[model samples]
Structure formats: structure tokens, C-alpha cells
Target: MTEQHGSDTGPRYAARRRRGGIVSFVVGLVATLAFFAFFPGMPHVIDWGAVLASLAVGALARAGCRAWMAKEAEKEGKRIGHF
Candidate 1:
């Protein structure tokens, strides 16, 4: 059996990318909530727009991580194929 040395696995990259997105989304949501909670009578009303914005932030984080990782892999001469 032959194994590639100093190479990255596609699944690992995918997982990392996904994690980045999830973490970003959670953080954004928490921050949004905290902002609203800072004032009295804020928690009584839920802001749907803030929730949607968090989703957007999450998507952007995932995309940014994917692009950055791919670029780094290319720079290192490692070809990370689609998984």
C-alpha cells in the first residue's frame, strides 16, 4: 500500500469548514441576543431579522474558510479535491 506524504485529506478540510460555519453562526446569534438583552424589555420581543443575519454570517464564514484553506493548500502544492 502507498500513502501520500505531507498531504491533507478532503474530508478533514470539509469538516473544518463546516465547523467554522457552525461556530460563527452560534457566536453571531449569541452576540445578537446579548445586544438585545443589554436593554430592558428587549428579550420580550424576538427579532427574526437578527436570526436571519446570523445565518448569513455563518454562510460567509464557511465560504471564507473554504477559500482560505484551498488557497493555503495550493500554496503548499497540495491538491485537495472535492469531497
Candidate 2:
């Protein structure tokens, strides 16, 4: 069933945005760090390219997740006659 809410941007919206930002940035940073960790022979210098790619990928993933969730919610809303 669709969730019952007074508005789309409810009290949790800010929290969710903050969390998502932190998560995405952390995931990006960790991904690059992990790659460097695996290659001991390589220079310790961080790969800015990989780090950027990680952030881009994380953003894409978040967008994909949001799209899927939105579709599901739309379906549920329609089913429940809420929209």
C-alpha cells in the first residue's frame, strides 16, 4: 500500500537528503580508498579520477533507486486511489 502522508516533502525529507549526501560521498571516498589499498605496489597518492568516478556512480545509483521507488509508490498510490 502507498504510504499515508500529508506532503511529499515531510519532516523526514531534510534528514533523508543529508543522509543520502553523506552516504554517497562516503561510498565514493571508500571505493577509491579501497582500490588504492588493494594495490600495495602503486603509489599511495589518491586517484582523483577514480574518486570522481565513484561519486558519479554513487549519484547514478541513488537516482536509479529513487526512480524505482517512485514508480512503485506511484503504482501503489494509484491502486489505493490516493493520486
Query: Which candidate number has the best TM-score?
Result: 1
Residue pairs whose backbone atoms clash in candidate 2: none
Note the Cα lDDT for every prediction shown.
Answer: 0.65, 0.57
Total colliding residue pairs, candidate 1: 0
The superposed Cα distance between candidate 1 and the true structure at residue 83, in angstroms, equals 7.1
Regions of model 1 farther than 4 Å from truth: 1-5, 10-45
RMSD, candidate 1, Å = 3.7
Cα TM-score per model: 0.60, 0.49
What are the per-residue Cα lDDT tens digits for candidate 2 across 1-83? 54645353434544554566567656765776677657778777667776676677777656655555456646655222211
The global Cα lDDT (0 to 1) of model 1 is 0.65
Q: lDDT tens digits, residues 26-83, model 1?
A: 7766766566557676665548876676566656665666677778877887657662
